[model samples]
Target: MTVAADAPPLRRPTRLAYGFGSVADGIKSAAFSTYLLLYFNQVLGVKASVVSTAIALTLLVDAVVDPLIGRMSDLTRSKYGRRHPYIFAAAVPAAFFFGMTWFPPAGLSDFAMGVWIFGFAAFARASMSMYQVPANALGSELTQDYAERSRIYGLRYWFAYAGTFAFAAFALKFFFVATPEYPKGQLNPAGYVPFAITAASLIFISILVCGWGTRSRIPYIRQADEREASPGLLSHFKEMGVAFKNRGFLTVFGFAILKWTAIGLYGATSLYFGTYVYQLSSGQLALLTLDSFVAVCIALPLAPKVTKWFGKRNTSLWMALIGITLGTSPLWLTYFDLFFPPGHPLLLPTLLLIGAVYGTMVALSLMMTAAMLADVVEDDAVTSGKHNAGIYFAASSFATQCASGLGILAAGFVLETSQFPGGVDPALVTEAMTDSLIAHYVPMVMGLWAIGCLIIWFYPIDEAKHLANVERLRAREAEAKARDMQDAPLGAPAR
Candidate 1:
């Protein structure tokens, strides 16, 4: 049975606090997707394959660890609660290791630099997983209302994008300013020092804020039974198997894998397109940060309303399709020379508008998926006699890491195949190189998006089914409570 639903609806301050925690995740994500490869490969002269390999390897290893952390969060009992302790403890090291990734010593060989990136990246991924897995699981615990979960996750994504914009804008505006000596500000080495420090500080602060802000939720959170047997390795796998057996979980899980891979691919390639294909300067690229800003503005209020109109599964599928179409349109248009040429006054503005819409659709899809994950918690609980939110979320996180890793690795392969010369000026890039990059990128990303869109059709839950599942769970809990009272000693309180 699920935990008591007596806790009051979350107030505005609490929701804001809860949403604010995702800022750390946002910063870390933006850093990895937007700047990490460029910094190492373009700035430091390490090969793109080497940097991508370092990132991909760490993510692959971390994917394996996510479930263990999720299972441990499920079992652990502490004064502060199962999720928060890990949440709090992860803050410092996560920031420290993330910061270290940007500060590799100068004059190192490419091999040595890759090793450095691999080592620091491993620690960074591990440390963040400590925070991310439990933090994600915590969202399912905070509320059980299906619609409310969507709203809560909408806010979560809102803050996530806000953090992304903040970090990206800051780096682009202040640190990565273009000069005569360095035409592409992103490739400037001196800027990385302050950028790392600022990012680390923000990561540390945001995580602690999330932990502190959500402490009130601990009392309302479901905890592991003190008397329940400790699960062994086989049991953990068995439990994970049970979670995946639910058709809803399986479908959403599959969709998340594909969706995130597309996202990772977009993140890995967007800068290259902006810098080379579009021939945008650093300041012009900085303006594109508004895309996320516009997305957050629209998504926060729009996602739940749209979900209410169309239902979660359908809304998610439609949004994914829309996002994929809009996001890829510019690339295809440019490829065919059907859109504004480089230096056209409308080029940047048109791209920005398209990005804004694309970002919103992606945000909506993610919110629906997260809400669906929470729904699966009860659906699994109905048959299995256990509520394993941790395992469900962990599996999703595992898919994310593995799929995103593959996407990043695939991006490396694309660059290698395109023979896009590293450590070269954007001005020196030729139309043939840009065309090869686009030709390789467009079809692969579209195929992944299409596959992901189709996977949503397999999800079994809708509003009615979800409500029915809630009723069944509540009825079961009532029976258990009555039986405990009947069996209790006369005049004693029942548990």
Candidate 2:
């Protein structure tokens, strides 16, 4: 929550280390979101509904796993500290399962393939939660400065988006390539093995690098209170209830759900839109992925300044509005034939321009939200008498997973309803089917994002309020410390 005015400032290397760690997260997200459904339904010949259902069912496990990991990490005391231990332990297995998800086996039935996806996805999701929940909590622990938190998250997201861009480009350019039999590189089954290995390697290495890099901060990070009792199963639930009582946490949590649900829909369908509706090749897709890199390069420097100018809440609201406008407008225009026709030279550029704007907005909004959530930790501590950043972030993670599952489910439903059969060539996809897909996608994305923006508009934590909360918390801590000193034996050293 709050730190004393004399608290140590975060060093540049430490911040960069934390930021670079998210490359693992980026690779996982990009590989899963962009290629998972396509790999299963299109290449592996699993039904769309089956693949989405498997993903959704597995993610439900997060409702239990995420908070449990958060609470356990909060109470954990070890030489390596609460967060890093889990972070380090999770990396290898997470990488193994992530790789396995792509390489199920040859000649499996649809039901068997679905079962394989579920098993591997469940493990991958669990491993990711182990690292991600605590890693995010560590960010809140790393700094108490308001603007500095924004900068930290900016670096984090910059690395995340950059990694995603690299993975996307690499997958399109090298892993997946057009062949005489498989015109679209992504539909080629053989390439997935190398792609999986590459992504898994990145995930493993980045997690270790981030964990080791931030190891020095363990001494400074908040420790478990000796006075507090160990959390029981009921206690974990009670703690979650207390976290939900914080209005600021709820605002961010709800916003994340809606925002990420929209993201889920977009991610699930993006490859489909690009391949079928826009008829983009692997090279064109690679070019489009560059939008994230360009956006982050521009946004990373500007995010903190803009947050200072507009405040995190307002900045996020504006960015969301702008993003929603940019993201959906092109689709609508193209759908109505108001933009260039599908095969026109301008179509790809137009879509790329939209991607650039939307990407920038996403970078800005994510940075603001992460910082805003960190601010809530102190406010939560003031009531609960302990900093539980892990739990709060875990709750956010739960929302994200649920939103992602729901979004993917919706995408699958849309595909099935549109009669977009599995294993069909993109060239055989009917114009009517593409139109129906966009028809389902546009309203779902726009409506969810609009609702999320509306919810965020009511977030109560501004800079002034956050600073006041921090001051109050510091005063409380000082008073408690003084009380402890007075109660100690005369010869005992001060705490």
Candidate 3:
């Protein structure tokens, strides 16, 4: 009987370095979802529909650009390797464009403002894709071990949340500080430029540090030429079509679409909810950022174990179910007057506790989904004879972007329908407006997340199936090498 072996665990530094790259993405996502809509509509006086339209246009462009970036990364051949060159090239431009979004020229019409937003946001998304898709594909390649992938991804998510927590805590406390003139700091326009500068600087630093830290692994990773034949331009879409034929990737992609849409909706609304619904001050809201820290603590240690015990699919499904339930519970509980009311001393702490637990669930779900997606690289390779980790991850990334686009649109719809006033004092907002906003927001978010949970049930691979696929690929490799040896001329110096 033969005992099976798994890949050795990645070194802690290697894992941490790779994980650090996620900080850029984390900050960007936090900005887009949490602050972008709020700033444009509430501070800059752009219509909600206009802001959503601008962002939606950016996503439409991303829908095309993301996959092309992925395929190009897969086929790229160079001394620095497939992913790093893009990572290095994109860092500055991504930061520059992102920073520019917050500093639009004054006195532009709504149409002009929309154009400005679409242009800068498009460039920023594309530039980030240059780094993110390839970097995520790199994570997939860092190890093939079934369980260890979970750990690596767990660390990636941990760093992401850490970055998010750090930024939120600092921005709310320092940059968006309440003043006599602008008591609700989030609605203040003066703070946005400084916020953009700090965030842009961090984005630049994290991408470079990740690139440098992961440099040593380049030689060990499979080079582009070592991959199967590169597809022609016409065949690129064909390549993507074939990739989705794999059931595991398709199901995960489906789930990610819904999951991210829900996330985007929540992000877009959280500020409104906190400011008007809960009547929380910026200082009190800063305290809520602690939820992310607590989530990191809970998720980093818990993800691998739950994934191992429950399997990735089950872990993801349960986490999504629980997360959405708890995440949205405060709304329902408050509606029935069964929970803390606004200005209740216990309300903020109760929310913090709920957010911490909800954040943990979301972190676990995200980590498991990435690990599950990584596993499909081998399974798809076995069937298609092509190693296209970049395309697979890119498709997932596009789904996330596309869904978030829709989520943002939904947020705008909610605001428009609810008659939620923009560029006004939160104290001036009426209870009826907030109640109407919740009526629209909660149902839409819950529905998207629930559907996502249903789709994830269809993911077909588990540890046993993953290990089998690995062994089968290894066997084919051995047989191919044997045939090459047999076919070589006698004393040909091993060809």
Candidate 4:
């Protein structure tokens, strides 16, 4: 559908405001992915299997709620606009529930704790989905230029990485620092409360600022076609069907599922790998948090240029390959003592360098994938005669949730089967347990990322195909406008 006006090219300020919103996402993701399982299983003495199952169930809930929110936003005709209303509304609840996930009541049984985890996790994830699905859809609505879209997403990824880096560093340095009672800061139960509060406050402020900053663009944003009847339930399902049929959407969707599953596994296991496998202290771990910040500084500027040179799909595939190699090689070397011994002074610095390289690849790959998805938005509009960015993004979100859920579930099974104990000291972790962690971690992460790279190779849309699609869509819209003018009543104003 045509917008109310020719949408202006996104200004640098607007791009920055939009990108800033991702800091909230980055904070929530860092907290949930990196620390949730560790906090519940190790700090609170809940079983790893129980925490994993609870999170997996919550993600399953998101699989339903995410798309519904997207479809609702797609059809919504509120005065404040389709996306911003939900984006603003989600801030408080998302933050509140997220905080609650970290602060369960004292003296609960394992079952009760699991129940509490499930309830809070579900609400927290759903609230974020309410915002994230629409915010992502809004990115496609912001601009139509292909190269410009890459730049926009590059900015978003940079902000996201920076935010994650800041949060991790802060937590490691201040909240989770080693104490007399708890040698590893992460094992301390007291630090999590302040961590939750800080993260929640940031989530609230970032979302509100983004919502307010972009409010002026409401006039230029696309609205539902007034001429068409309001969609019924069946029609909403039909819209989802149409979105899934687009080959470009499927390409991105499939790749994201595999890639995110790998990421989910990595996030779930990173604490264990760092603490037990590599024997890193909280202080040393904090130093490693700088990797993403360095990557963003290097990769954000390079993303658009690389996309211009190799095309989005090719760039994404190559970057994923490189990322998997860089991310996994250090671990393999450490395991086999191929390089410096694991406890050697130089090993941490060498690992940090590898992390930096991997992080840069990850940032570039994500930037390309987001840009590729924006291209698919235009392709969908051309083929379906509807701009269903929300629906498309929601489907992608669904895949992401599903992948993360399965990954958590698999992690739980591995932990239980390997007989990993809860509330244990890092020094007490057995060699067999480290081997189990490595076996589960390496294959899931490296293999799935490799598979994602392969899947992305078949993505049909290229720069040429996307530009052709945009032209065809412009012609179709022009023809529709002409027909509308011709059919207007004698005294009525033409739409």
Off by over 4 Å in 3: 1-9, 226-231, 480-495
lDDT of 4 at 252: 92
Q: Which residue pairs show collisions in model 4?
A: none
Which model, 1 or 4, shows the larger lDDT?
Answer: 1
Per-residue lDDT for 1-495 in model 4, tens only?
A: 545556676788788889999888888777877788888888888898888888888877887788888888887776777789999999999999988988887899989998998899899889988888999899988887888889999998888876778778779889997989998887888888899999999988888877888887787777775544377777777778787788888889989999887777777777777788778888888888866678887998998899889999988999899888888886676556576655798988888888888989888998999999989988878767778889988988788777777677766776787677778888788877877666666776788888888888989999988899889987877787788779988888654
Enumerate residue pairs that collide in model 3: none
* Candidate structures ordered by TM-score, highest first: 1, 2, 4, 3
As for model 1, its CA RMSD to the true structure in angstroms is 1.7
lDDT of 3: 0.86
Candidate 3 weakest lDDT stretch, 10 residues: 1-10
Q: TM-score of predicted model 4? A: 0.95
Query: Per-residue lDDT of 52-135 in model 1, one digit per residue for the tens?
Result: 888888876676778888888887776677889999999999999999988888788888888898888788878888888898
lDDT of each residue in 77-120, candidate 3, tens digit only: 76777888988998999999999988898899989999998999
Ranking by lDDT: 3, 2, 1, 4
**CA lDDT of each prediction against the hidden true structure:** 0.84, 0.85, 0.86, 0.83
Model 4, which residues run further than 4 Å from truth?
A: 227-230, 483-495
Q: Which lDDT value does model 2 have at 265?
A: 84
Query: Cα deviation in Å at residue 73, candidate 2?
Result: 1.2
